[model samples]
Structures are given as C-alpha cells and as structure tokens.
Target: MAAQLSEIEVKGVKIPLIYEKSTLMPAVNLQIVFTHAGSITDEIPGLASLSARIFNEGTKTLGSVEFAKELENRAISLSVGSGNETLVFDMSALKSEYLEGLRLTRELLRQPNFTKEALSKVKTDIKASLLRKESDFDYVAQVELHRRLFEGTPLEYPSMGNRESIEKITLKEVEEFWKKRGVLRRAIVLVGGDVELEEVKKDLLSLLSVLPLGEEGELVRYEAKGDLEVKSVIKNTQQAYIYFGSPFSVKNLREDSYKAKVAAFVLGSSGFGSRMMEEIRVKRGLAYSAYWRISLSKSVNYSLGYLQTKLENEQQAIGVVRELIEEFLQKGITEKELEGAKQFLLGSEPLRNETLSQRLSSAFSAYYRGLPLDFAKEELHKIEALTLEEINAYIKEHQELLQLSFSVVTAPKE
Candidate 1:
C-alpha cells in the first residue's frame, strides 16, 4: 500500500507529509523537498544550485568539519541536491536516530553559516568542476542541446552557470539569494520506514516551522520553435556527440503523457532492444551508445534522443537517427514491440522503488507534481490498458518529432 499523504499548516505555510510504517527494514528515510527552490527559479544563473550546495557546509552553531563529524558519528547520510524545479535535502538513518536527523535538518535549513571562507572554497571547487566539464564530450553534448533547444530562455544555461557569472557572484549575494528563495512555503516531507504518523508529523512540523514564508518568484518557461537544423561545434576530438528532440508539452497526470512514455521507450530509451540502439549501433555499427529521454519539469517538457559516434561518421549517424524517427512515425510500434516496451517500463518500477531513498524520492516527486501517492502504479495501470492504435495516433498527432533540433559536438573536417 502507498503511504498516506497529509498536509499541515505552519504559520500560513502548507507542509505536506507522508506516513509509511513499513517494517520492511530497521531504517528510516526522510526526504524534505522544497518546491520552486532550484535552478528553474534562479534569479542569477547557478545561484540556486550553488546556494543549495553551500547548505551542507555548516550551520551558524557548527563548523563545516564538526557538522560533518556529527552526521557521520550518528551514521546518518545527508545530501543536498537540486533539479531544475526543486531543492531536496535527503536523509537516511536508523529508526532510532530519526529525531537527531530532524534536528540536524532544522539546524541546516534554519541557520546555514554561509561564511566567506566556506563560500570561497565552494566556488573554487565548483569552478574547477565546471572547468572539467568542458572536456567531457557527453556532458558538453547534453548541455549544448539544452543551450540550442531553449535558446534565449532562462533554461538555456547550465545549472553551474558560466565562468563569468560564477566569477561575479559574491558570498553576500548567495546569502541574500538563499534568504529570498530558500523559504519553505511549500515543504513536501516524505518519511518511509518503521515510524508512527503522528510522531513523524510532529517532528517535521516543529523543524519546518522555522522556515520563513516568502513571496513566490517566476521563471522563464521555454517553448521550442523553428525548422529542422543541426548546430555543430567544431572540436579537435575523435568522438562526436549528438542529441536531437522536439519540444513536447504535456502535464503530469494527463492521459496523453502516458502515451508519450510508451513512444519514448519504443523509439530509443529502452536499452539494447530499442529502435535507435538496434539500427544505429548493433545493425550498422554506427555509434557506441544510443538513447532517448523525455524530460518533464514544472515549466517545460521535451523529448530528446542522444548518440555518440566517431567524428568521421557524425553526419551519417545524425541522418540515420532522423530516418529511424521518420519510420517510427510512419509505422508505429508493432504489437510485440509494444508489449515488450510496456513490460520493460512496468517491470522497471520495482527497481525504481527498491531502496528507501528511492521510495522517498519518488514520493517527493509525486507530491511536488501534485500527484497522489500511488501515481506510479496509476500510470502503470494506464500503460497496461493502452493500445498500439491509440499510441500511434498520439505520435501521428505530434509528427513534429521529425523536426528534432540536433546539437552536435565534433571536430571539423579537414
């Protein structure tokens, strides 16, 4: 059974909580998700992610190293990371230490000591990481796809920001940025393990009430437009990275969204048996890995496919990908293929929720999207009842998949 999701109001803020008392293990997993607190809402590029990273450094009452020691001493694993739309602080520890976990969460969220010294060190580390990402062909390729696909929009830049932006950001600016955006006006807390509903709710309410209420902010939503074109960056490398996709708009729980998932799987996302992998990599020996993905954020949703090949065969590889997409559009998935894809997607749900952290994350995701606790199962049933005809019709309706914007990173020909 799914956890019972409830909401509590703390000083006019609505905080959502999940109660799951599964004695499956002796551990407790807590996920604290703050909506609209990630890169998607960045006033300054990378500020959302950078500010999130700074939270783990220490609180006003504890230094960075001591803070680290305390969490380690309790065998608690705490992580702070951000996606495009939300900031997440995930904690996993024994059921016996749940109170301490909540206390530490409160400390970090309420009194993060973003000292100049810590800020300087973090900036230096992130700058170095950004520098390294430049040499990563796959990373560069993925980022470039977003850059071109979402050009002139807020979503275009990488979450880490550019060197110029990071260089200009000051410690004072990050503190202010955090102050403005870090308020948990909508706190979605999920707890899974051996714990009572009332106990967890009380603990979360007290800790979360410390978060001040702030006004909501806006972010630029990206809408893809225009003709079929390939944007290539010339480099002096042997491998070429390519990604192509069309901008797709679908809501979280819409019927059409489920069909979209089936389409994605049949096209390329489904591993070695997928269309892109079979035709591009296995049949023709064109690329090493071929895959497609559908990314849905609160503001924007799109479907993209990626492959990497030798620089010599980059254009050929791109052409092949376009051809396969056209064929799939003209001739949608076969009955066998449809069933196989459905099984793969459905069966994969277990692995997705196999761990406590995974369950917490999924619950957080569901809550973030205003979905019910059993959304994954709900979608699985939807997928089970879908027909090939309906799926194909949806694909035909969105035939602009042929107009995928290709972003390629490869060396210029001699």
Candidate 2:
C-alpha cells in the first residue's frame, strides 16, 4: 500500500516526509544527512568525504565483494557523498526490497569494516584520478583558483585528499575517524515515494539510535583575504581555459542573492543570450563556449567565468570577456534582459525538483545548509520579484570588487 506525505515529530526532532501513491511498481528513495559532522576541520581535513567512501567498502557481516554483489543482485542503488558541511547517504530500491535495503544501510552505517584491502583500493584509485586531473587544464585552473581563494583554511585542501594524504591514511585512522565523526545524533533521514512515516522512522531509529552522542561543534569558517585579482599559469595545450571572480559571500546577501544570480545569468550564464556569449561567440567567434557561475559557501562566495579557444585567439577571447564584464558592471543589464533571466530561472526551477531523486537530493542540500525546506522556491520568488533598477544597483555596488583571473593551455608554436 502507498503512503501519503506527512510531517512527523520523532523524539523532539521535526522531520519532513514525502510520499506518493504509485500505480506502477512501488519505489522508494531514502536520503540520510549528517549535519555538523561534515566540516573540514584541521584535525581531519578530509574526514567527511573519506568516511562516506569507506561506508560501502565493507560492513559488519559482508565483505567488500559480498556487499557489492548483494546490492547489485537486489537492483539497489546506493550512493554516499559529502560536501563542505554535510555528509549524505542515499538509497533507492523497489518497495518489495525496502526492508533489505534498510537493513544493509543500517549495517553499513553502524559497522563499516574499513579493511586494509578496501583502503588500499581507494587510495590507488584516488592517486590515479589525481594524476589524470593533472593533465586536465580546466581542472588545474579550478584547483589553483581554490588554493588561492581559500589560502590557509582547511577548506583549501581538495575534497579527495591528495596522493600524499591518502597514502598516509590507515585502516586504524579511518576507524577512529569514523567513530569520532560519524555519529548520527544530528542526522536527518528523508524517505520519499511510497513509504509509511512510522515505518521509515522506526527503521532509521533502529540503526541510528545506538550510536553515542557527541559534542556539537561549530562549522569552520574560511575568510578570503586581500583584493581579488587576475592570476595566470601557462600550460601546454591548443586552447586556454580562463576563470575570473571576486570575493562575494552568499550568506551576506541571503534572499537578496537572487539579484546577483540574475545579473550573472544575464551577463554570462545564459549560453546564447548572455553578454559573454554575444561578444565571445556570436560577434567575434573567438570561442564557441563561454559561461559564468556563482559559487556560495558559508564563509566564502565568488563568481567564476570561463571559455576555451585556440592559442592565437585566446588573448582575444579573454579581452572580449573582460570588456563585456566591465560594460555589464558599469551600465548593468537592461530591463528586457532582466525579465528574460527571471523567466529562465522561473521555468528552470520546477525541473530541479521534478523527480523523487532530485527532491531527495534537494532535501539533503537544505539540511546541509541549515536552510528552510522551501529555500529553493523562496529564492525563485525573490528572483521574480527583483526589478531592473535593483539589479543595476547591485552591479554598481559590486563593480569595484570584480577581479579577472585566467588560465591558458596553448600548443607550442611550429
């Protein structure tokens, strides 16, 4: 039987639940998020990501191979990934297999094996991936940009600890880290699709309640120092990948961040309609692709734009991008542009939460950020309410902070 969506209070914690009655085969998506445990503290820099990686490596009763085979045989999809401030574990399976899926998830969370063999495989894979990243121009540029921006903060370290760091990690260290940081006391488990609220809560509590509670700690804050400026490094390739931005904190703007986002979209985010696309692709054809994005963190915020073009035309592309940004900052986007960007945002918003998987993912994101469940929708409403004058005013306020950064990969001259 399919269950209806409802909110429930469990042991003083308010949990949001979503359920849909399906005529087709019953399917369920479950996401569990651990808050306050995902921080990149100086002591265990990559602890969150590492813990998530080792979750499925092995469990109490199942060895690595056996555990993997079990999920495959059951047609279960399980994923564990972490971000700056949250660690997430997601499971999707048919309702008929729901009990089995929950059992496996509980065992994996409570009793991960963290064997030496599994750790070795993870280390080897990470090292190979890092080597591959070295040859990627865009990757190199983005890594450098983060290093420069974050500087001394623990957040500066790559999510996948470097080769040296990963090599140093041992099974014992992983176990200790897991014990100290993997407590599910503050975790939120969301079950979507055909699921009974009581059943879901009962299952989660059975596994999560046994874990000992730990001291609640504050999230690490990273402060960006100095003025934003352009930095470049030369690499051997035919095209250049450029990135530009300045210090802009999303937390500071809150709901008002919509204006900044809309401005960015009008300026360079919209592939074809964006100003950068007009100048760099349509008018001059210096590059076939150009776009910009805004990245927000608890303590850090910045905008980045990039394009790829031949070595000879790289300089032209960079110049045009800079010029267009300068013009946008000075004059601001027109009323028509703002309207179009808002409509694009409004139309795109629904697609983001259209599916069970997406909604569950979004719920995790909200829990991670300490945002209201309706933050996405509210943000869209804010975007629709923004006026051209306000956006232009925002551009003027942020113009002086704009900094252009570039990384170019070019082929050697014949």
Candidate 3:
C-alpha cells in the first residue's frame, strides 16, 4: 500500500509528512527541503553547496566529535546536500531513538559553528574537486554547455562553483549566506517511514517554531535564448565530447510537460533503438554511444544531451545528431512510439516509489513547487491518458528546438 500523507502547518510553515507502518521494522526517515538555499541563489558560485556540505560537520553547542557520537549512539544517519536549486537534510534512525536523531539534526542546522578549521578543510576538498573537474572532459563539456546557454546567470557556473570562486568565498560570506538562505522561507519538510503523523508534527513544531522567516532569494528563471551554434573548448584529448541542447520551458506538473517527456523518450532518451542512438551509433557506428533527454525544472528549462566520438569525426558526429533532432522535430512521433514510451514510464512508477526515501523526495519536490503532494501521481495519470496525436502535436508545435545550441570539448586541430 502507498504511504498515507498529510499536510500540516507549523508556525505558518506548511509541511508534508508521509506515514508508513512497519511493525517489524523500527526506522523512520526524514527529508527536509531547503528550497531557497539551492545553488541558484548563491552570491558566490559554490557557497551554497560548500556550506551545505559542512553544515553537519559541527555546531556551536557541540563539536564534530560530539555530534558524530550523538548520531552513532542512536544508530542514526544524517546527510546534508544541495543541487542547482535545492538543499536537503536527510536523516534516518531506529524508531526508538528517532526523536534524539531529529534533535541532533535540528541542532546541527540551527547552530553550526562555521569554524575556521572546518571551513579550511571543506575549502581544500572543494578545491581538489574543482581541480579534478578541470581534467575531466565530461565535466568540462557539461559545464561549458551551461555556460553557453545560461551566460550572465547563476546557472552559468557549476553547482560546485569553480576554483577561483570557491577559493575567494570566505567563512563570513558563507555564514551570511546561510543566515539568509537557511531559514523557513520556501522550506518544505517531509518525513516518511515508521511513524505517526501527529507525533512527527508535534516534534517538528517544537524544534523549529521560532526560526526566522528569511527572504525568498531570487534568480532569473532559465529560458532558451541561444542560437544553434557550437561552443568549443579545445582540450588535448583523444575523444571529443559533444552536448546538444536548446531552450526548453515547461513548468512542473503541467499536462504538456508530460507529453514533452514522452516525446523526449521517443526522440532520444530511450536507449539503443531510440532515434539518436540508432542514427549516431548503431547505423553509422560513428560513436560508441549517444543519448538525449529534456532537462526541466522550476528555475530553468532546456534540452541537454551528450555523446562522445573520435576527435577526427567530431564535426561529423555532431552533424548527424543535429539532423536527428531536426527530423524528430519535423516528423513528431508515431503512435507505436508514444504507446511504448507511456508503458515504459507507467511500468517504471512502482520501481521509483518502492521506498519511503523516493516517495519523500518526489513529494518534497512537488510541495517545493507549490503543488499539492499528490501532483506526481496526477501527472502520471495525465501521461497515461495522453494520445499519440496530442503528444505529436506538442512536438510539432515546438519547432524552436530546431535552433538548438552546442558545446564541445575536443582535441585541438592538428
């Protein structure tokens, strides 16, 4: 059975909690959504990610060792993470010690020390990561593609921030950013597993009722603005990495967005026999692999995809991929393809919702986007009811994808 979910407000902050009973099991999981703290709102490139990474390192009330001991003694696991547009605090514990686990997670978030020592270590780690990224063509192609498409915006840079940016961001800046971003504003807390709704609600209110309602920070929502042009970073490498994309905008939970998803699968995201793979790999044998997919979110909308091939044939490989996209856009999709894609999605739903963690993540995303907790399930219904004509029409009308953009990291001309 699906977990029972309820919505409640604590001190005017709406939160969602999912309840599932396991009489034999004694664990509960929590996924706290920190919406405004995502990297999109970062004043510096990687401040949000770095701050989130070190958030659980220690607190003013208790040092790192003590915090570790608290969790260890209770058999709890805690993790802090941030992506392009969201920060999350995830914790799990035996039901017997769940309250203590919650208390410690709350303390770590509410009163981090931001010690110079902790900051130094984290900076070193981030720097090492950035250095490693510099040598990776895959990372280079991905970052450069975003830079080309999202220039002059926060999304233009990497979520981890670049070396110079992360190095220059001071402890003071991180703390200030945290003070403003890490609050009740645009926050949705989701918990699922072996617990009751009321007890979790009561405990959460006690833990965070007094948090300052911080500002909802801003970013210019991403749009497709670039032209069909290839931006290249000439690296001394054996293979050329290529990414093709165009501006794509469809809000979360929309009926058409579901159609767009099916369209994407039929066009490129589906493996092997899909259009991109069939043309660029199987038929021509130009590259070992090629794939495509739509990248959508509340903040930005775009199609992003990648393939790698021998440097000498980089332009040829890119040409074939573009032709595939152009043809797919013009021809739309067949009834057979649409039906297959729908079944692929519908069959995959159970696998996705098999655990409390996955359901909590989905519910949190919906709630973060100001949709009801049940929006994901409803959207699937939309997908199921979609007709071939409807999705094909969606593809036909969106010819703007023809003016797609490209970014390549390739070996320099000999």
Candidate 4:
C-alpha cells in the first residue's frame, strides 16, 4: 500500500514515476509535475500561474466549454495548478474512464487554448481575485511578510500576482512559458489506483511522448532575511493582523529534520497545548489563537507564524511574541512538552497515511526534497527514539529563528 518510485525513459530522458496501487475504490489519480517551472522561475510575475490557468481552459480545437463537457461526460476531473517551485497537471477518473483521461491530457498538452480570448478570461478572473484579497487582512499581512523577507527575490512577488501584473501578461508570453516549462525534461509522473504498474508504465510512455524536449531551468534557493525589522501597514480593520518570520537554516535535512519537526510542534505548531498558544492566548490573553510553522523545501526555508488581536493590544501582542521566541531559544523546551509532541506526532501516523492521495503526496515530497522514497517510514523511527537532549540541542542551535521580522496590518488611529 506504499507509494513506490520507478522511471520511464522517453527521448533519452529519465522521468521519475511515483505510484501506488489501491483497489479500495475503482478510481485512479494522476499528477504530472514539472520541476523548475513554477513562480520561482517566472521572469514576469505571475507568468507561471497565468500559464497554468490557460492550460486549464482545455484545448484550442475543443474550446473551454465543449472540452470540459467531454470530460464531464466521462466523469473526469482535470486541472493544472502551480506552486512556489513547480507546476502540476492533475487528473482523476474512474478506472474505466482512465484511457479517455489520458487522451484528453495529451490533447490539452498538445493544443492548449492559448488564444487571446482565453488569456482575457483568465486575466479577468485573476484580477478580480486579486482585488478581493485586498480586503483580507491576513492575506495582506502575509504578502507583506514575504516582501520584507525576500525583497529582491522572486519569492517576494505574490504567486497570484497583482492586478497590474496580470494586466501586463499576454497570450504569447503564456504560450512561450508553457512551451518552455512543460517538457519531458521537467516532468515527474505520479499515477495510482486500480491499475497495474506495467500497464501504467506503457500508457505513460505514450501519454508523455508528446511533450517537447525543453531546457531545464535552475531552481534558486532563498533564505529568509534576518532583518529584525517591523513593517506596519494601515488598514481599516478592527483587529491587528500580525505575521512573523525568520531564517531557519537546515544544515542536514535527513539527519536533523525529525528533531526540527518535534521542536516546531512543541514550540508553536500544536494547537492549544503549544507554547505559543499557551503563552499568548491562555496566559496573556493576547489573541484567540497563535501558531508557527517551519517550512523546508528545495526552493525556500523559513519559520512563519501569525495571529490576530485587537488594534488596542497590537503592540503588546507583538512584544509577547518576541519575548516567547527569545525565551524558547534561551531555555529550550521542557521534557513534558517534548513527550507530548512525540506522543501526538507518533500516534497520528495512521491518520496521515489513511488515504491514497496522502500516500502519493508523501512520496512526492520525499522525492522532491531529494530524500529516499522510504524516508517517511524511517522518519517515524527517528522521532520515536529521539532524546530530549538531542532535540534541545537542535533547537538551541537554530538561534537565527529569533531574528524575527514583523508585518502588522492595523487600523489607523481613531
């Protein structure tokens, strides 16, 4: 029931295949992920996202509505989405409809609706979405945090792009970006559910043969800037939206990552019982909830957290956040906290792996992070045997996390 890794050779290029067979339902899911083709590689802000939207419009021959109807008739779901570091074409259909799904996927890839009409429609949709986000204080705060942390880097730009950026995007640019990024070289195939591996491999060879050979671009890694600066935005809001981040250097991902997980869980990730929630919410009454997350990936690494409180209590909440982080760095976590984190993380293993999609995602994460396919199983073993001293040592070593940068959005003085 575990996802396994294999490879298919097309045009002398090896494409990674991550798959798992599950007969629990008569359904299948597939995701063709392109590396180095996401927002990080965009020469123009939102080019990657814009290209994905056009791909979702179906083929040039069928047009959007008719193409969608064909898939709906077969009960197939096909879509393209972009992330910070990759673009994915995802499909799901019944076991019987899978062949039709493959044929449709090829059609989309070979003849994407890159016309002026499609570009105008997608641009209008994205611009409206961007306008709506202006009213979301949390979104505004998070975007500001990224801007301050990544300043000159690609990460600074919003993935969905501002209205101006979307307006500047054109059909020709979208076509070029898609043609350059969607290639045999960048593809990683993930297919599973109610199919044999041999049959899947044979079908994939034909489905992927249509992809043009493209030059792979380099994925640049960005580290959170340790500025210790507070940037405030004036918004007409009752509550102050606070977003905080700092650098978290992961020296050895495989050896020290489990410790980071436990440390992060004990510090801020676990709700109610976590140190951040216990101090900021339970004791000080600064906010209803507080949390923190450690994000480590091939393209970026950082510690991010957020909370909201009354505009009147804004400064006090920020101070409490700083004090808690400094205290955590100085004192590390207690044995009780460590034990609780371990118990919770270990006990929740089954829930995390209960479904086929979860298994596929876990496997993809392992491959994406340049770790072994069995890394998840091995990580559980490490967490179960981890010692308090070891986790504390790891926590104390990450002093860079305390160089916090704050992005606060609050109402103007009344």
Candidate 5:
C-alpha cells in the first residue's frame, strides 16, 4: 500500500505528521498526547494516568455507566492509557461513528466531573488491584527492581501507587492535579484512515478551544545513579521470581543504544535464540520460562535490561547469568551473534507496525519523545546498519556496569 505523510498547523498547535493509507475498510486512528510536568508526582507517581481514568469515568453530563453505554452504543473503542512521560487517549471506530466518538472524547477531556463518588470508586478499584498483586511473583520482582534502581527519585514509585496512597487520595486532590497539569500544554492528535483532513482539524479545534493555554511547565529530568542494590521479598511459595540489571540510558538514539538493543536480543529478548533462554531453560532446565526485556524511558533516556527466573535456581541462576554477562562484556559479541540479532530485529519490525493502532500509537510515542515520526522505520534501518565491532565495543564498555536486585517468593526453611 502506498502512503503519504503530511502536516497540518491550526492556530498555534501543529499536528506533526500523519500517515494516510488507502484501504477498503474505513478506519481512523487518533493519538492525542498532553505534555504536563510531574506536579502530581510528589503525591502519587502515576497521577497523570489516574486523572485520565477519572476524566473518562464521568463528565459533567454523563455518569460513568451512561458514558460507557454511550460508547458501546456507537461501537467505538476509547482507550485511556499513559506512559511514564505522558497520558494518551486513543480512539478507534468506523467512519460513521467518528464524529460522535470525537464529540464524546472531547467532552470527557474538557468537562470531567471528578466527583467524590468517582474518586471513591477509582480508589476502591485500585486497592483491589493492589491486593491481587501481592501474590504475583513477577509483579513483585518488577516492583522491587524499580524501587532499587530508582531509589529516592520520583520514578522510584510504581506507576500505580500503593494502597495507602490510593486510599488517602481525595476528589480535591484529583481536581488540583487536573488544574495544575491536565488542562493544556503541547497536545498531538493523530487521525488516520478514511477521513477528511479538514473535518478532523475542525473537530480537534472545537474540543481543544475550551482548554486554556498557559506557560508550559519545565520537563522533569530523571538521572539514574549507577548504584546497584539487591532486595528480597519473603513469601510462602514453592518458586521465587528474580530480576537483576543495571542502568543503561539512551540519551540521543545513539549507536550505543542500538547496539545495546541488538545485544539484549541476543542475550535474552528473542525468546528462543537468546542466551538466557538457552542457558536457563534449555541447558540447565532451571526455569520454566526465562527471558529479558529492554525498557526505555524517553524523558530520562534510561534503559534497563532485566532477567526473570524462578526461585529454585535463584542463586545459581543469578550466578550463571552474571558469568555469561561478564563474558559478553569482556569478549564482546561475535559476528554470528550480531548477525542473528540484526535479523531478529529486522524480522520483528513489521510486526510492530502491523496494525493501525500500533502505527498511530508508535507515531505518537515517537513525536512525544522528540523523535522523528518515522522513528520505527529509522530504528529498523539503524539495526540493519549495526556492525559486529560496534556491538562488541558496547559490551566492552558496559559489562561491569551491571547491577543485581532480587525478589524471592518462597516458604521459610525449616
């Protein structure tokens, strides 16, 4: 399918880039990202997402149930989700429902009630969710990892706050968070598939006109301390979940970042071919499943690689993982491994952009992170262009920088 990219400027708000695809099925993907500083971070880390959820719960005229029913009636899927840096509200619907969907979305964004009842329900739901997380070994491990890695920083807290924080939150607090950070800043709205550009622009303006523009707040910059610490969570279970890693931040989409990504895939990310999978699962039979993930934070340019394994081989597993990591760091990756990583990354690129939702979401994230709208495409190119020497150099530079953190879920020894 042929694609054309274009930009639209309305008033002071500039819609960065839009990719239009001519298809038989009519579909529109819109991404609206709001930029607000972390004022609410002091109270609750994920206050931005909490505020977005409350806004969707009810507006001035529609109650929670009514709003949901209206959305269902239109066969529209409205999703309110966020990342560490921004809150994103995405909508997908047929051409016929686009106008109404946009209208309802605008109402929810501009006229949220933030009523006491809504706040109570949200807190109650969050508390219940937290209760359920207590028994989840993987969740425990991940949470402990963040706590150790980002100690004393606002990013140390989970995106979903703890039960005590949630319980203490009030409607007034929610309102204050909204007023301080939710109203206006830089907002990007993306609409794709079978839509008139002019109409979409008008719809966006109508909703955005009600929002007041003010001095954009300074961006919150997070710096990762190179200190690595270990933590353990005691629980009465047969298996334990363990994670360990170090701070690897990508500041400017550098070659090191790309090499690190490729190296991580060879080390753990590709599921079957990764070194972690081969050693932990295939060779040793130590874990039922073992893999690694590369988490990138655009605002802070922080990236971390994590390895999750079961408790039976917790100590041994960490030891073996560390040894392999040390070897990679010292000797660096081979030509064969680099080639395999590149192929795996290039093969997976298409999957990332397979759906309209993925495309729009990726575009929004790229723009939000101060990257080109074609960041994904660029990433693929970068991966393809990587050399074995560069990958080896990255490993040589960062091998000793690794950190270890633990979360154990096991019964006490007799």
Candidate 6:
C-alpha cells in the first residue's frame, strides 16, 4: 500500500505528516525528521552529529543505561542520527508497546542526557573511531574528494567531524544546537504500520508538546568544484583507492530527476552491466569493480564514483575512467543499454516498495523534494516511456561532469 500525505497542527505550527496503515505486521515505525538541521547547518564542523549523539544518550533523569534498559524490556528500538541535510529520530515497537515507545521518545527529547560525562564519553568514542579510520584508505580518499569538491563550504567537513573538531565540541554547544534546531517548525513526522491517522496525530501532539518554536534556517546549496585537479595521499597500501567527483549541472531538479536516474543507471550505477563496470573491469581488467552515481539533493549536487586497483595500474585505471566518461558524454548510451536500464529499474520497482517503511520513506522523500506523494508511480511511467534520443540529449547536455577531479590514496614512490 502507498503512503498518504496530510497535515497536523500543533501549537499553531502545521507539520506535514506521511502515513501508511498496514495490519500485516503488528508493529509501527515513526520518524521525526528535522530539516536544515544536519551537518550542512553545523556551525562547528560536526555539531549536528554530536547533537544527535547526545540525544541518543537518553534522558537526564534516567541516564543512558537505565533509559536503554526500560526500552529494551519492551523490545523497542529508538535512535537519533544526522545526515548531510537532516537530523532524524526513529522509533519502532510492536503495536502493543507503541505508546510506551512514544513516551520514551518524548522524555529523551525533552530531557536529553547532555551531561558533561555523556559529552566526554561520546567525544572519546568518536575520536577513537576516527583514529581507527586512519588506516581505512577508502574513507581517507572519499573525505579528501569531498574536501576538494566543496572546499570552502560546510559539506567539505565529514559528517562525523574530524578529531580536532570533535575534541573542540563542548556540551553547551550541543545543547544550544539542539535547542535552536530541533523545533516544531522544521519537523516532518512519518508514521506507518498498524496505526490510524487520528491516533498518530494525537501521539505526535503529546510527543512534540515539549518543543519550542525555534526559528527555521535556510538550506544553502554548495556547488561542486570543476577545476579538474588531482590530489593524492601517500599511504602504505598496495592497492590504490581512487575517488572522483565533478559538477552535475541539472537546471531543474524535479523535471530532470527521472531522466538523470536512467542516465546514472546506464552510465555507472547499475554495477556489472553499467558503462563504467563494463569498460573498467570487464573490458580492460583495470579494477575488480567501479561505480558512479549522480547525487542530486537539496543541499548539493555532484557526480561521485570510486574504485580500487593495484598500485602499479593506478594511473592507467584513472585514465580509462576519464576516457570512459568523456566518451559517454560524447556518444551517449546505446539503445540496448537504455532498454536494459529501463527493464531493471521498472522490474525492481516492486522490491523497493515491498514494506511499509519503504513506502513511508518514499512518501517523505517526495514531500521533501516538493513532488506529489505519487511521484514514485509517476517516475516509473516516465522511465518506461523515456526514449533513447531524449536520454542521449540529457546526457550530452551535462558535459560539465567531465571536469573531473581525483583523490587517490597510493603507496609512496618506490
């Protein structure tokens, strides 16, 4: 079943609600999403992420362990996390324990465990995780790529922040960030599975009653740099980790999004059958696998892809990738490639919406992107009717993606 969209007013704030009722599973999942409150809005690198981490530490009154135990006793799952563009609180429980789950969520939001001890512990853990990632060449390359693409913007920083940034985060800053950003004005509530709309609105009112109507912030879209620069990191690894990105200029996000999907699939995102995989891996054996995708979002738009290969073949692999992309822009995809992409995308549509949560996520995404709730179905129709000429024209139009920049992690000169 599809998710339905509606609105509910609390404290004179109208919040959009996405809901789907299903009785097949005796459980429910709710997500409280805060827009323009994620890493993109962080004043200090990782403030949004640290704020989410603190929120997950449970209530001030109960503390982390006891608060977790209370939820564990009822087999409920609740978590808070931040991504590039939004912060989310997710909760899931059996229908019988839904209200109890909501109770804990409210408590967590109203009385977060923002104590000094919790802040120190979370910072230490994040630092340790960052230390471990030092050895992860893939992570190193990916971060470096973003650093180059969005050098002066908030997107340049890793979502989890760096060691220095995390160390500089104080408990007071996290508290301030949450108090200002986590407001009713920025929230969109999503509920699905075994619940009625009236019940959901009542539960949400009770859960959100504690939040203040803080000022809403505007989201700034960062442009990807198109300087065609190459940055390399010297590491002790035998295999080279190479990541690449460039500007994906789409003038209209909504009208061109479906065409971009089909183009992305045939060019790189569809794995073995895609252009990148066919040329880089199967054709020349440059790497075991390679991938690329068009990341179109509210805050940023770019093309990102990565691959790994032996140190000796790193330059050749990079050249082949560049040539492949240039050729793709020049010649576009074959009719066979277009048909294969359409078949796979259309055929796999069912699996994508097989669950209530998936449907809810889709509905929320539509709302977030300013599209109709039925956009998923409409997108399928567009994909099905897409012509080869139209797709090729779309591909040839975005030659800006050829201004590729590379981030490579490889061994030092022998």
* Cα RMSD, model 3: 2.0
Q: On residues 1-414, what C-alpha lDDT tens digit does candidate 6 reach at each position?
A: 678888889899999999989999899999999999999998899889888988878899999899899999999999999999899999999999999999999998899999998998899888899999999999999999999999999888899899999999988898889888889999999999898989999889999988998877898988999778778999999999999999988788777999999999988999998988988899888899999999989888899999999999999999998998999999998999999999999999868988888888888888898999878889999999999999999999998989999999999987
Q: What does the lDDT come to for candidate 2?
A: 0.70
Q: What is the lDDT of residue 297 in candidate 5?
A: 53
Predicted candidate 2 versus true structure: per-residue lDDT over 1-414, tens digit per residue: 322335545454554554443434588878776665663642545556666777767675787789899999999887787777667778889998988888788778777767777777777777889889888888777767666767778666777767677777777877776676565455666777676666776776665655556544577666544344556676677677775555654435455567777877888788899888888888888888888877666545677777888778866776777788778778998989988998899999889877766666665555446666656777888888888788898887765445655545456556
Off by over 4 Å in 6: none
Candidate 3 residue-wise lDDT, 266-337, digit = tens: 888889858888888888888888888887677877888899998888889988987887888788878888
lDDT of each: 0.80, 0.70, 0.79, 0.91, 0.68, 0.91
Candidate 5 has a TM-score of: 0.91
Clashing pairs in 5: 30-190, 240-311
lDDT of 5 by residue, 14-65 (tens): 5454555535577676766666534225466656656667767867688888
Q: For every model shown, what is its TM-score relative to the native structure?
A: 0.95, 0.89, 0.94, 0.98, 0.91, 0.99
TM-score-based ranking: 6, 4, 1, 3, 5, 2
Model 5 worst lDDT window (10 residues)? 1-10
Worst lDDT run of 10 residues, candidate 1, spans 218-227
Model 4 lDDT per residue over 3-122, tens place: 899999988899999989999999999999999999998888888998999888989999999999999999999999999999999999999999999999989988999999999999
- Arrange candidates, best lDDT first: 6, 4, 1, 3, 2, 5
**Deviation (Å) of 412 in candidate 2:** 6.8
Count backbone overlaps in model 2. Answer: 2
Please say which candidate is ahead in lDDT: 2 or 4: 4
Runs with alpha carbons beyond 4 Å of true place in candidate 2: 1-25, 42-47, 225-229, 251-254, 367-370, 410-414
Deviation of model 1 at 335, angstroms: 1.3
Judged by whole-model lDDT over C-alpha atoms, candidate 4 comes out at 0.91
- For all the candidates, what are their Cα RMSDs to the real structure? 1.8, 3.2, 2.0, 1.0, 2.6, 0.9
